[model samples]
Target chain A: MKDRSGSVLRLAQPVRLWVQRFTFLLLLATAAGLMLLGKADTVIVERIRVEMTDAVAPVLDALSRPIGVANDLIEHGRNVYGLALENRTLREENARLMQWQAVARQLEAENAVLRNLTGFVPETAATEVSARVIGASGGAYVRSVLVAAGARHGVRKGQAAVAGAGLAGRVTEVGDRSARVLLITDLNSRIPVVVESSRDQAILAGDNSDRPRLDYLRANARVSPGDRVVTSGIGGIFPPGIPVGVVVGTDGGLRVQPPIDWDRLEFLRLVDFGLGGPLRGQGGAGDPGGRP
Target chain B: MTPAGGTIAHRVDAAAREATPAVLTLVLILLDVVPLRLPEFAVITPSFALMSVYYWTMYRAELMPAPVVLALGVFQDIVGGGPLGVGAFVLLATHGAVLTQRRVLMRRPFAVGWVGFVGVALAAFTLTWVIMAVLHLALFNPLAAGMQYVMTVALYPPVAWLLLAVHRSWVQAR
Candidate 1:
């Protein structure tokens, strides 16, 4: 009996080792194959990505709520300490803004008259959908965020995501219940922008850096630090004249300092300008005509 | 000792104990993807999952096996929106390499284990950077990757200590 048991144990040990080795090799090979497949078959990989994201979006949305509350609590505490000082500043700013408000109203009335005289066809109005940010890029070389709203909520690819006073990013992928917003700071992001002060066209190209550089400006373009950059609407992906960023540095190596306070971003307003962007088949495919 | 329901309870407890390592690793992967909302935190979210993977792969290889690692890595890749299978490849390579060096790591002092972890993190980050550059066919700025590696390595002691405590109380006691 002892000899028989010993022989069985010896056989099982080698078999177990072989099984372990085989499993390891198989998993390694599978992982390598997936990398190649991701490159070769992007459509399927993207589908899987969005489906997985949709599955987890609810959990992420639930998880991020507490963090948002905590952030607000901290912000409130900071504001409380400066309440008196802030109130005075706000009061002064409000007075100043009231003057500007009258000017803006007068300009709008005059512009309407001018448009009527020219028989001009007005551009489509934009609608905004609010979404809460649930996931930021996970320390990879990517700059993106996942928001809780998706195609079901009228969020679509190439819609401009505005947050924290200016443009943040554009929707790159949309699922049934979640969407991924690729930030303007990602390496692959390129935006057609014009320097507002000089009206010189250039492309804002990101290199995985916070300050995306302005490239391909006309040779004689006058670009200086503090020049405002706005969407040029060349591709129709974004509407013209949206506030993008402020230029930094000279014409040689210009960069833009986006107004977004990245750390404090908890919500986004995705604006669809009824243009359907250039990627869509028709101009009005994404038309949600009236303002939200 | 008791019959029927007591025996079922005991079995359930046993199963939970067996699942502790993998469950903890999964939780860490989730933590890695969750936005912390800290200033500049996105660029250096420190590979919390990698730390857990390294710990379990080094000490409890059977519990954190290759298949489990692959599944967890894939989940991380999907959630993080990174290139598919990159996480799996990095983790599987780490698991394979650590298995060969287990004997040495097992007998060493904590400091030596940390040094070993630093070496592993270096290799892992470098491999990831190379794969990303190749996949994009463009040279990525290594500064963020380098920063993440520094933070990951710096953060190992506390994470390992937590895992060690869990292993001692739950896994080893059983």
Candidate 2:
């Protein structure tokens, strides 16, 4: 009886290993299958993205706090060290800016008079939903940031996310308490913009670089380096005239330098410009930011 | 205690033991998402998720089985905003390569095992870059992906140390 039991036990070992290996292969196959299915751009895959972001929002928020504080401290230290030089530079900049302020005021008054004669309906003022940036997925494949604000906080997909400097990204995947913003420099980003000085219109397309290329410009568009680029608002997603980038030329073509630095992003103001953002359904009752 | 009670307790213990590697891997992936203060860390921080999976599979493959590794890969694809299944397919390939040589690696010293990892990582990263280009339907600057692979291989030693320490503390007894 003992000899028979020993033989049985020996046989069971290999059998268990084989079963486990088989199961592993099966699961791997299933995972690959899901990936192929995801390429269909179905609602189900989007739902999965939203649900998973919701589940992990709180955890990411809690973890990002210290990192944000650390960044602030470093910035403060640098500021104090350069206080003297900064004061002189700021004084010069302030004087220059005052002249621009006077010019702007005069232009505003003229614009108002022109609008009154033209019976132009002014665009609605944008409402801001402020939130901390908790996670940023940066790589060659993706350039996206996750903010603490979400569907629960009146944020919806396609709403523009802006920093103090300029336009940062647009909300792509929104959960209950978190939303993912695809930065302008991501591999898949495409935005319609016009040059501030020349008024030359073009499409800004990201190629996973710090500077995104300006594509489809008219031949001899007369665009120059250092010209400002702002949203054209042709898609009705972003508000018109929001600053996007500055023009820079390379050997290949013109590229735009994004106003906001990727490393310096801590907080974002998700703007509801009332342009009828995409994915406006479900949750956050009575939020009019997304309704058409 | 009744016999049934003892069996239940044993079952719980077994489940927890099986889950240790999964929890570790998940934590590593979470760390990858946070924007820490280190320069060039965001894009080029060595692939923490990949290293953790490789290490656990080397020492304790049973605990960090294929299904759990598969889930980690899909989670990466979702969070990182890449084409789905790319990570899953690549990771499984690495794990399979490791499994074929696990016995030899276990018998050899750490240096030999590191060399083995170098081989598998090269193949995995090449496959990943090719898949990414195909998915995006355009050729991207290869420098970024190449730098990422180099950083991942170089940081393996220190990260493996941390993982080893955690494993000894939280899981050695279990």
Candidate 3:
């Protein structure tokens, strides 16, 4: 009986080891299989992700307030140190600006007279909401920012988000107290844009890079480096004439140096342009005859 | 042995064994998500999570099971915005590689084991690059990927030490 028991014990050891190893391998196989199969329908996943992001945006915003304050304090100290020289420069610029302001008033009077003669009326500006950027979705992929204001603050999906400088991107996902703004640098982002100097239309395409590329530019388009780019309002997604970026010439094509510094994004403005209105039939607000 | 004492000992041994693998899996997941940016070495970003997976497989294969490692890889895939099985395949192969050389690695000193880890990480990263290239039909930029690998490799030593400390504490406490 003792000899038989010893042999059985030795056999059981290997059996147990094999079972453990097999079980582990099986689990890994299942996880991989699930990931591949589960991610097949990204549209549904993206919807859910947007909703979740909106829900958490406000909480993140509250938490980030202290960091924002600290940054502002440091910036203020640096600005104060250079205030004297800056004031001197600003005084000269102010005098130059006053001279230009008088010329601008005269041009505006002349332009209004021309508009009256042409029966043209300017569209009223839309309501605006100011929001603070609370968190950043920093990773190898997915360039998104979370802002404090959301549905409660009249922030809606597809609203044009901007910073102090110019157009940032559109709000793709919104929540009750927060929202996620997809930056123009994301691979999936595309915008209808026009060259400010030449009036040539082109599509701005993001390829997960800091500077986005301008596609479909006409061969004879008179675009040059340092020319400003602005939204053309072709798709009705964004309002017309929002400053987008400056054109930079690349080896292969033209790139846009976005007006908003994506890396150091802190605050954003969501223009409540009342896009869900009779603006579709009215054509683009900025266009003279409401024609494409 | 008395029946009551034997049962208690058996229960304690099973519980201890179960806890080891669970703890290691949690550590691996945590390392995968925490963003550690080093601006000085612009080209190379190290992945600490990959190192953890490699070390645990070599040191305590029984505790760091293949399946958990695979699951971790899949989670990384979803988070990294790539095809789901990419991380899974890379991690599965890495664990398998370590398993094949388990006996030799177990007896080696820390430095030899770390060097072995670097080799394993390089292989895993290369495999992932190939898979991505095939899927996208574009040549994966070696410089961009190499920078990430360098960062991940640089981060391995401190993370490995931290994992070791945690394991020791858990084992002693148990």
Candidate 4:
């Protein structure tokens, strides 16, 4: 019996080894096939990504609340650390700014009146979905984030995702309970942007870098560094006038620099622009051209 | 006990033992999904799951099968938001390398093992980087890949120690 078992083991060992080698090669082949398949129809991959995101979004949302609290606590701690100096500075500034506050309040009241008279409505109605960033696509090739929001929370693909400070990115893949945010710094991310001062239109392109470059700038456009860049609301992706980033420098004839600190991204607010169509809703009634 | 009966029991015992590694793999998968915010050194957060698999495959090769490694890799790919087979490819390769080198690794000193880990990690990182480059040619940046490689290597010692400690305790308990 022992001799028979020994012979069987010896014969089986080579077969097992061959199977192992074959399996490894098979996995490699499958990986190559997937790469080719993914490239063939990018849309299918995007759809699968969305479905996966939507499915996992709720779990991400649950996880985000604690992150949000932790962020608030950190911010509060920072505030506390500078409270003594801030208190003294604020007290003197308040004494001087009390006069300006009245003017500011007056202007705000007047602006409200004008908005009412012109039938100006904010693009996104009050309903907002808050999500927590669970994981980051920390690879050099992709600048996407996995957030904890999905179909249950009304987070759909193509929705604008913004951080606490300003625009972060947009939802590209939505699963049942989770979604993926393709940040403005991703190679594939592109936003229709307008230079705040000049209103010069261009496409903000992400090249898998911290600062996305602005492309398609018309020749002789008067865009300069330090100019504000906002969504143009042309592509029906993001709402108009949403702050994206500040123009830091013109690189290769492209305006660059993001307003939001991409490195320290933690939480995000997915904006729900009420208008289900292009953000260029009939310009607020007051402006003859409806241009903000 | 009869010899024939004993052999069958032994086979069942081996199969049951395999389940322990599967449980460990699942726990690692859960850890990958959970955003456990480590205070410092966040960028180079050594992949705990990868280390766990590596350690188990080295000590308990029979239990840590190739299929489990591939499945875990797929799970990581989905969670990490990379192409589906990228992690699987990296991990299967790592498993194969570890298996081939296990006898030497087991006999080597701690320092030698560390060097072996560095070599393995470098190979894995290179493989992953190459696959990612092919997937996104325009987006591939060597500097970022280098930084990640450095972080992974720098992090391996501490991660290896932790895995060793866990293995020791688990083995003792068993």
Candidate 5:
């Protein structure tokens, strides 16, 4: 009986090994198959991704706080170290800004007069919801940040998120109390941008880099280095004239150097232009030639 | 205590013992997303989950099976916002490759295992780049993946040390 049982066990060992090998290969195949399915970017896969993010968010939030506090402390130390030099620079800048404020008021009056003459309708002021950033990405695959405010705080999808410097990103995914801001440097992001100085339109396309490239410029589109890039509002996804970045690099491969200090991000302001998009309802195309 | 209650308690303890690999893998995955607020920690950090999966499977192949590794990989991808199934393919491939060479690896010294991990890291990163590049139909910048692979390799020793401690404390004797 013992000899028979030993032979049975010996036979079972090979079967177990075979099963293990089969399962491993099967999993690999499943993974490849799932990758193919994900290519379509269907609603189900997106929902799953969002749900997964939501599930993992709290644990990550708790884990990230201590690190964030340490980061803030280091930044504070740096600021204190540079306080003297920074204060003098700020004082000079403030004085210069005051003079510019006077000029701006004068220009405003002249612009209002011209607007009255031309019967121009100014854009409505944008409403905003301020929120703290909960998560910032460090991977090249996706450039995004998660904000604590979501639908609960009036943070809607497709709204522009801005930092102190310039346009940060757009709200792409929103849960109950959190939303993901796909930064302008993400490979998938394409912001309809215009050179604020020349008004030459182009698309700002991110290629998983710190600087994004410009696309779709007209022939002889007189572009030069250091020109400002702003949203064109052609797609109606973003409002016009939102400061994006500045053109940088040499003649051939010009890129927009965004004003974002990628090292430090704490809070963002989400601007919800009530109309949301041009296709949504109001046809405010900014067409001066249309019948008024 | 009654004998039946004692037996039930003993079974629960045994079950918890069995779940250590899965639990640790899950925690490592949670750590995967904990954004370190350093500029250098930018976008691609070390693969803590991968290290743990590889270590646990190498040491206790029966306990850390292919299904568990596959599940952990999928869970990590889901949470990490990685390309779906990419984790599974890479991890399962790693598991299969290691399992085949387990006899040779188990006989080797600590230095050999560490050296072996470098090759594994390379394969994992290369596979990731290929999968993503093919999926996107564009060439991905290898710089990030290369950095990630280096970090993963750098981080392995400490992570392996911790896992060894856990194994010694909880898993080795019984």
Candidate 6:
């Protein structure tokens, strides 16, 4: 009986190894197949991605609060040392800003009169929803952030995510309680922008770099360093004249230096301009006009 | 204690033992996706989940099987917001490759295992870069990939030590 059992066990051992190997191969192939499926059927893939992100959004949200606080504390500690110098600089800037405020008010009054004379119809009222960034794409390939607000908070796809003093990115995916913002630095991101000074139209294209490059500029667009780039609003995805970045390099390749301090991007103000065009109401994966 | 109660406790303990590795791996994955908020930290975030997989697969292959690795990879991909299934493919390949080397790796010293992990991580990152490039139809800047590889290799010791401590205390206690 012992000999027979031993032989049986010996036979089962090889079979078990075969089963394990087969299972491993099957799973590996399944993973590869999923990648193809994700590319072929992006709508289904996006739905799954958003659901998965939404499920963990709360856990990530709770986990990130302490880290945010810790970072703030560190910044505060460093700021204490530079407080006096910062105060002087801020005071000077405040004085300058006060002068600018006066100019802005005058411009507003003059613009209103000009608009009334031209019978210009104003755009719809814009709305803002402030959201905390809960997660980020830690991998180098994707530059995106998961904000704590979602469709439930009136955060829709194609809304502009502004951080600090410039446009950060646009909303690509929105779940029940979480949304994903594709930053301007992502390789997949493209924005129609105009040179604020020259009014030359160009496409701001990202190559997974901190500084996105300008593409498709006219040969004699007269673009130079220190020129500002703003949304053209031609596509109607974003409102016109939103600050994007400034041209920092015009040699070899044009690079725009966005004002956003990405490291300190803890919060975002998602702005909705009530403009819907070619890129609206579709999964941003198949965006034809570089809407998001 | 009642005999039935003792049996229930035994089953619960066995279940917990089986779950420990997966739970630890999931936690590391969540850590991988958490926003570090440091300058350029996102681009070079180490593969913390890979360390967990390597540690468990090296020591306890039964608990850290290919299916579990695939599931964990999918979760990481969905949460990390990268191209879907890329993470799953890379991790599944890592598990298969490491399984064949398990015998040799097990017999070697900790430092040897660390060296093995360097090769595994390099191969994994290269695979990811290639797959991403293909999907995007453009070559990604290899600078970020190189930085991530270095960061993952530099971070292995502490993560491996932590996994080892967990293995010794909770996994092997019974």
Chain A TM-scores of all predicted models: 0.86, 0.88, 0.79, 0.73, 0.86, 0.92
Model-by-model lDDT, in order? Answer: 0.85, 0.80, 0.69, 0.70, 0.78, 0.88
Enumerate residue pairs that collide in model 1. none
Write the residue-wise lDDT of candidate 6 on A1-292 in tens digits: 0233346648887677778888988999999998888777467788889998999999999999999999889889999999999999999999999999999999999999999999999998989999999998887799999999998999998899999899999998999999999999889888999999999999989888888999999998899899999999876778889999999875648888899877667999999888852255444455454535
Docking quality of model 6: it rates as medium
Query: DockQ (Cα-based) per candidate?
Result: 0.67, 0.51, 0.18, 0.35, 0.55, 0.77
Candidate 1 local lDDT, A115-233, one digit each (tens): 99999998888888999999987675788889999989999877999996789988878899899888888876888999999999999988788889899999999888998999998
Interface RMSD of each: 1.2, 2.0, 5.4, 3.7, 2.0, 0.9
lDDT of 2 by residue, A156-257 (tens): 878888988788888877888988888888877888899988888899888878789999999989998899999987656677799998999999899998
Position B4, candidate 3: lDDT: 47
* Prediction 2 TM-score vs. true: 0.90
Q: Can you tell me the CAPRI class of model 3? A: incorrect
lDDT of candidate 3 over A167-214, digit per residue (tens):
887786666777767778765578899999899999998765678889
RMSD of 1: 5.7
Model 3 spans > 4 angstroms off: A1-43, A47-142, A145-156, A173-180, A270-272, A277-292, B1-48, B55-103, B134-140, B170-172
Ten residues in sequence with the least summed lDDT for candidate 3 chain A: A278-287
Evaluation by DockQ, superior candidate among 3 and 5: 5
CA lDDT, candidate 3, residue A74: 78
What lDDT is reached at residue B162 by model 2?
A: 85
Docking tier of model 5: it is medium
Clashing pairs in 2: none
Stretches of candidate 5 off by over 4 Å are A1-10, A109-119, A250-252, A277-292, B1-6, B171-174
Position A120, candidate 2: lDDT: 100
Error of 3 at A251 (Å): 2.1
* lDDT winner, 5 or 6: 6
Q: TM-scores of the models, in the given order? A: 0.88, 0.90, 0.71, 0.79, 0.88, 0.94
Which structure is stronger by TM-score: 4 or 6?
Answer: 6
